[model samples]
Target: MPSYPGGETEKAAYDLATKGEKLVMDYLNISIFDVQEMPIDLYLFFMREAYIHGNMRTKEGREYLENCRRMEQTKPDRKKIRKKIQEQKREG
Candidate 1:
């Protein structure tokens, strides 16, 4: 149900979502169905704690952090997308 502007912006959004989903699933050893059916409030809270605060303490968390770094290194377009988001925040 989520919609995004077309082209690179949309692609970037999907790419980011895929990465996040993978991180959550891998960390929890949960299926995609679990993530899909999770309540929004719980999902947000879990992700915030597991993905951010969990960093370097657990194996899964450390792997996720390393994967994130690798993603940023390989995907140069993410930098542009980030800048655009920052500009939008400033304008809003």
Candidate 2:
């Protein structure tokens, strides 16, 4: 099978760029505002690459991929998963 670029490259690049910025911020005390746009443009490049050669395993797979794409586009923040504890309180 042809090795296709994974469809999550934009998210991956975002993650990488964030890490890079974080490193610079932590170590060099540089501001993200100083070099902000290159990563964003690189993100678009990643998207285009994925669009051209994303792996579509099945129709359902394609749908799932698109859903993830939308999610990344929106940067959908997820609520923390907290476990609910059962309380045994008896009222007299």
Candidate 3:
């Protein structure tokens, strides 16, 4: 994951994606935890809809953008950490 270098526009995109995910989950009667295991195709479809149709200037949208930023920053780190753990286990 990397920072939203595009500033407000990138933030808006991330916010839209978050809102889209939530809406999809709620519509499907799924919990937040279940989202992690959601099918990528469905996720992408929902996110695309969100970006294309969602209003990114709303208050909730802005608030959730922070989460988007945090997730972006940590995504790559999680993979790297997992790889490191696997390497350590192999060595040990």
Q: Write the per-residue lDDT of candidate 2 for residues 1-92, one digit (tens) a residue.
A: 11234533344333453644454444434466743544767544544444424447467557656666665554433432122222222321
Model 1: lDDT to the true structure: 0.64
- Once model 1 is optimally superposed onto the true structure by TM-score, how far is the C-alpha of residue 75 displaced, in angstroms? 37
TM-score of each: 0.40, 0.22, 0.30
lDDT of 2 at 11: 41
Residue-level lDDT tens digits of model 3 in 12-72: 3333546655866765667767766878887777655554334356775655566556657
| 1 versus 3: better lDDT goes to | 1
Off by over 4 Å in 2: 1-55, 75-92
Model 1 weakest 10-residue run by lDDT: 1-10
Q: Rank the candidates by TM-score, best first.
A: 1, 3, 2
Candidate 2 has an lDDT of 0.46
Q: Rank the candidates by lDDT, best first.
A: 1, 3, 2
Please tell me which model should have the higher lDDT, number 1 or number 2.
1
